[model samples]
Target: MHYLDNLLLNTDSYKASHWLQYPPRTDATFFYVESRGGVYDRTLFFGLQTILKEYLGRPVTHAHVDEARDLFAAHGEPFNEAGWRRVVDRHEGRLPLRIRAVAEGSVVPTHQALVTIESTDPDAFWVPSYIETLLLRLWYPVTVATVSWHARQTLRQFLERTSDDVEAQLPFKLHDFGARGVSSAESAAIGGLSHLVNFLGTDTVAGLLAARAYYHEPMAGFSIPAAEHSTITAWGRDREVDAYRNMLRQFARPGSIVAVVSDSYDIFKAVSEHWGQTLRDEVIESGATVVIRPDSGDPADVVHQCLQRLDEAFGHVVNGKGFKVLNHVRVIQGDGIDPTSLRAILERITSAGYATDNLAFGMGGALLQRLDRDTQKFALKCSAARVDGCWIDVYKEPVTDKGKTSKRGRMTLARNAATGHYRTVPLADEAVSLDVADAPAGYEDAMVTVWENGTLLRDWTLAQVRERAAAERL
Candidate 1:
């Protein structure tokens, strides 16, 4: 017989020992997690189901726990011996926690409960005790989703101003080139799928796999054969025009898109002379859209310049919105695009009388790994705990930073009466009520039961998540 070690079992080795400690007579504890609203004003709720599955795989059996126990004991049990002992004592081989969450694709305001976790059995206190460790991994995917969703919103605003059909162009406007730039294969997977939740263009196969594995999507994203500097410069600087032509010759199938890195030597010469003059007729006759990637220089300035050069070479078409789109050519600015630069590039193009659809963007590090927990101020704290069979409201208020203050008691995510906006109301709030027939008219419970001990209650597909994300703008 052979066994595969649970490699992910050591993910939370850095947790404090006090997490393993509870009151002597404690029966159970409830921990609620939220974003608390950070650098970004709003939070797009995502990735709860995905992260839960990642941390706790299908039917964690006794063999899995035995492997984890063996692995931990061999490593000298660095973090806490007592915690491992308690896990062993309580090990039924499956996680004993119940996970309740808002729907995976639901977009709610930040500082609301994204997930609430607690023990499933009244007798076991350690069931949901690992929540602080388990819940931390969720912050990254959620932040990435929020950032990418905002990028989609930003692109939609500019596209709506410049084109009549915003939906047709939105999916292809932002491409993911961040696979190689991310920290690990898993990072690429999480960050890549997060971006694809709002768009359809991607090069990250790992992210596509994540969508298939976690969200049950048959196809999550699409990309075309594209050129890099090495592919072009390998043809030598002298044969740059030949190299540009070769990309089209190779990938110029009907209705297909081919991207060529045009800034190999001189971006201006490549656009104005090579793609513009030498290969202009071939590009137009090939029945393919030629995408030119500007790899260097100031992205906003260089992209606009590339668009203008393409417009001069390929000619221009004025859409119904009266914005000019260069025919047979488009610019993909992949060099230095974050959310800030992306907005800048679009604004420059639109203000310069060019359509936003004239160009697209490919983001790398900024798309995948360039975020911190505070990007959305995510924090998971114990809001209510049962002591002596009485539910006690737990909270922390700090004098140093009022923003660091945490919410108290059980939280009810409900719509405001007058404003009709979703807001987190504490159980103690005079205007708030829960789990009753006479609850406020506008208040609807946003949180739903997603996971029970060793069983997944709800499953979502990638297309469904995309639909929920698109609804955020509407």
Candidate 2:
């Protein structure tokens, strides 16, 4: 057995003893995962499909049970061997749990339940909470997707105000440069794909492959020929112009775009002297757009200076929006960019009469690695439990931290017809299950059963996810 494939060993150590901690006569438990509100007003739902397909879809084998039992026994934690064996023997090793979530890519307001889980069989009541460690990790990808989505909104706002072509240029404004900045290949695959849900520009190959493997997308993103500081500086300081020329000679073609990092030895001189003066005629006659990448200095000031130099050399035409756009040269600031810095850079350039379309952005650590579960205050808590055939509401309400309070009872995400806003409401009864198609009058249940008894019920395509994410509401 692969070391990481053991579902029993994937959770917190304390979870190994949870089966013995439930209340007496506890026959079932219901739990839900929510963003209790944090940095953003809305959370974009994502990555649950990847988790379900990659992890929960696999069954628990007898070998997995035996390995986990011995490990837990040696680690001084209790292992529920009988419970696991029963699943393997009677239920054919499949987890008897039902999971319902809002459709992937839905922008749900924080504090509403994004996912609900419960064991379908009475004997497997503890299974839901036991897997909370893995399920709640969904917060990572969801937060990354939300961040990317919000960045998209910011870019769209600036583009609409400063550029004539908003729709055509919005998709490629923010590029994902986050693969190496993340913790692992899995993080890159997950967070990278999450960013792709909102943008079409990415340098992370793993993200594109993830979309193909999990979301059934042939090619979810695009990247152009580009150069890094190493490639430029390898030619030595005296040969800097040769390095820039080599890039154009190799990759420049009609109607193509190529980026070359120009900050290795004096960014201003490189952009103003080399790209603007030395190669001025070559850049114009190449018939391809050249993107100058400045990887150092203050993001706003550096980008503004590069744009000014490029406009001086290439000349610019004022569009209908009265913003100056360079002829065949552009600038991409890939350094020191976050939500705050990004806004500042856009403000600086637009205030100088440059259109937002004259620049694009590539974010690395800020896009993928700089976030945590607390960034969005994600939590999965048991909300209801059944004992001796009687259902009781369950929750946590700490007076010291009212923000940490958990919801109670079985809940459903309902959307009002008149307001079109979503709210979490208790089910009519413990046994009631509402479907979106046949919802109660004036309210629609946004939750859909995505997985049941170890089988994937809903598989979303990348295009569908993008469309849902782009919706104004619902």
Candidate 3:
């Protein structure tokens, strides 16, 4: 590692000795994560393997401690011993947190154990005990996946009603444009790949790299060659047609697709006059799909207009389902698209006598940055603590806010056989079986031991996650 890399490792100055008062009992503290499920009924499990492999797997080296132990000791003041010992007892300097949870890609119902964390060695309880931040980090990708999963569900509903081949078109319907809109490159990677769990289209380069690095998938998402307004407008309005022609020449090949920003000047004229009439023959003969993107305007209104105009210019063909599709042309509404607007756009296009296949939606800021821990009401709390060989149920029932009331005791998530809904059960449940399929009549454990100590017990690739995420029972 470079000197700078080592320097960066000891950067968690705030978390150093911050656990001095946590757990209260120095021997052991048990904690588990759950989503209280305010806005979402369930959360799609994702990114745990990524978090473990990327963050906790890379432990703080002794060298990192040697360089910055003094500052941490000073920051801790009277608790300097806490800081010093963490470095002195470093075992490959990695965090000594052991985690157990449902398998990654499992669609866990609300108020269930996402993961439970405790110190591996009793003496090192403090090492993993101060975990508000560490445990909370899982919130991002989980929330992203949940939101994207619901979006996929919504699109699937529309596709089922509107498209003949719902399965074929669902993946490409929602594309990730969230790379530049997120807080960092890492966020782009995690959040982008989370969206890819449900759908395959993405423009976030870091997301693809993240999938390759963390999920061991060489290619996690796919995108078409596309142009932005800067490239289109740079050609000037007078040469707009030339720019469109050049994009087609450079990117459009047989059985290929490319997107071009058509709203640089008048989106209507560009769609109707240029792409519709003037370049109609080229578009028809090019044997490639030219996707027109409207970068600005109300998505519902603008995309509805684009679909009708494009159908007029390029002509329309009815699929088996009787939905009109423009020949060699499509519309991608990227501006102001959220779940609400996405559904609205689909509704408008279908109501305008076109199929949901007539358009795709691209989401940027709303897809990644517009969420928080409260988006799904995520919380990690001590539900059980082991003291002197006895297990005690632990929880907080904050009267000030009933919504903040947390679950108590050592809990295991299990699928209730009668309703097929997952429910959190006390660990002592007589019928609890870890394997859902093998479990007897009443209950099956939904939670699986995914991580133990520093070893990742179960690993999942992007394809595996996509498959598991698609599986209804997982």
Model 2, 1-474: lDDT tens digits are 789999999999999999999899998899999999999989999999999988988889999999999999999999999999998987888899999998898998999999999888888899998999999999999999999999998998899999999999999999999999999999999999999999999999999989998999999999999999899989999999999999999998889999999999899999889999999888888999999999988899999999988888889999889999899999998898898899999999999999998999999999999999999999999999998888899999999999999999988788776776898878645544665555656888888889888889999999999999987532
lDDT of 2: 0.92
lDDT score at residue 399, model 3, on the 0-100 scale: 80
Q: Can you list the residue pairs that collide in candidate 2?
A: none
Model 2 TM-score (2 dp): 0.98
lDDT of 1 by residue, 172-203 (tens): 88898899987899889988888888889999
Clashes of 3: 2
User: Could you say which candidate leads in lDDT?
Assistant: 2
What's the TM for model 1?
0.91
Distance (Å) between predicted and true CA of 124, model 3? Answer: 1.8
- TM-score winner: 2
Off by over 4 Å in 2: 430-432, 435-441
Consecutive 10-residue window with the lowest summed lDDT within model 3: 428-437
Q: List lDDT for all candidates, in order.
A: 0.77, 0.92, 0.78
TM-score of each model, in listed order: 0.91, 0.98, 0.91
Error of 3 at 38 (Å): 3.1
Residue-level lDDT tens digits of model 3 in 1-474: 565454223335565555565545556666778898857788998888887787666556556565555555656532334453564475556555567777677787787777777666666766554545665779999999988988988888887887888889988988999989888887898899888899889999898888888888898889999999888888898999999999999998889999999998899999989998888899878899999999888788888888888877888888787788788999888899898999888887787778887778899888999999899988888776666656677788888988888778766677665776777766642122255454446887767666665677778778888887887532
